[model samples]
Target: MSVFGGMSKGERNRIKIRVRTAMATQTQVEGRYLGGLATPGDGSPLIDAYRRH
Candidate 1:
């Protein structure tokens, strides 16, 4: 059986909520960096390249 198989429904929901929040925060940070790189005359295409991912 899986490690989390015995967890209650509430426990599982809490874990899922925490994970989703963390992922959202990470994505926001990445998007902020991409926006900074996208500024006029910055001349770095790295952000644009990552934006496609």
Candidate 2:
């Protein structure tokens, strides 16, 4: 079964949007600063992305 099988269409769509936005932001940051992609030595991507301000 699909992972989203139990979710409503709207819920799944919202998740897609969030994932896309996160992925785009991650790619942009990685390219501009981290040299195109996340490296193992760079540490956690999620933690770097959602840092406290």
Candidate 3:
């Protein structure tokens, strides 16, 4: 069994929530940075890829 198998349900849930929160925060920061890099009226490929998501 994996390490999580030994954890209580509540503990497992808390860990999952923390991980999701971290990922979301990182994505938001990345979005802002990419937006700043993007220009008005037809951006570069990097900006296009970022907005496509």
Candidate 4:
């Protein structure tokens, strides 16, 4: 059995929600540091770096 084999459905959903929230917060910060989010056609170096991942 895996380490998380005993976790309930509710517990798993909570974990997923927490992870999604954290990722969204991180993306917002990255966008701010990259000179605000821009369209793909902007062709900015910062946006390029952000889109690399």
Query: Which 10 consecutive positions of candidate 4 have the poorest summed lDDT?
Result: 31-40
* Total residue pair clashes for candidate 2: 0
- Which pairs clash (backbone N, Cα, C closer than 3 Å) in model 3? none
How does residue 43 of candidate 3 score in lDDT? Answer: 55
lDDT by residue (tens digit), candidate 3, 2-42: 65675777698999999878877887887533234545556
What pairs collide in candidate 4?
A: none
Across 1-53, the per-residue lDDT of candidate 2 in tens digits comes to 56567567769899999987887898788753534555567584444656677
lDDT per residue as tens, model 4, 1-53:
55466567668899999987877888787753324455566674434554656
Compared with the true structure, the alpha-carbon lDDT of candidate 3 equals 0.67
Instruction: Name model 3 segments beyond 4 Å from true.
Output: 1-7, 32-53
- Error in Å for residue 36 of model 3: 24
- Give the top-scoring candidate (TM-score): 4
TM-score of 4: 0.47
Residue 17's lDDT within candidate 4 is: 100
Candidate 1 residue-wise lDDT, 1-53, digit = tens: 56557567669899999987887787788653323334457664444554645
What local lDDT does model 3 show for residue 3?
59
Off by over 4 Å in 2: 1-7, 32-53
Cα displacement (Å) at residue 48, model 3: 18
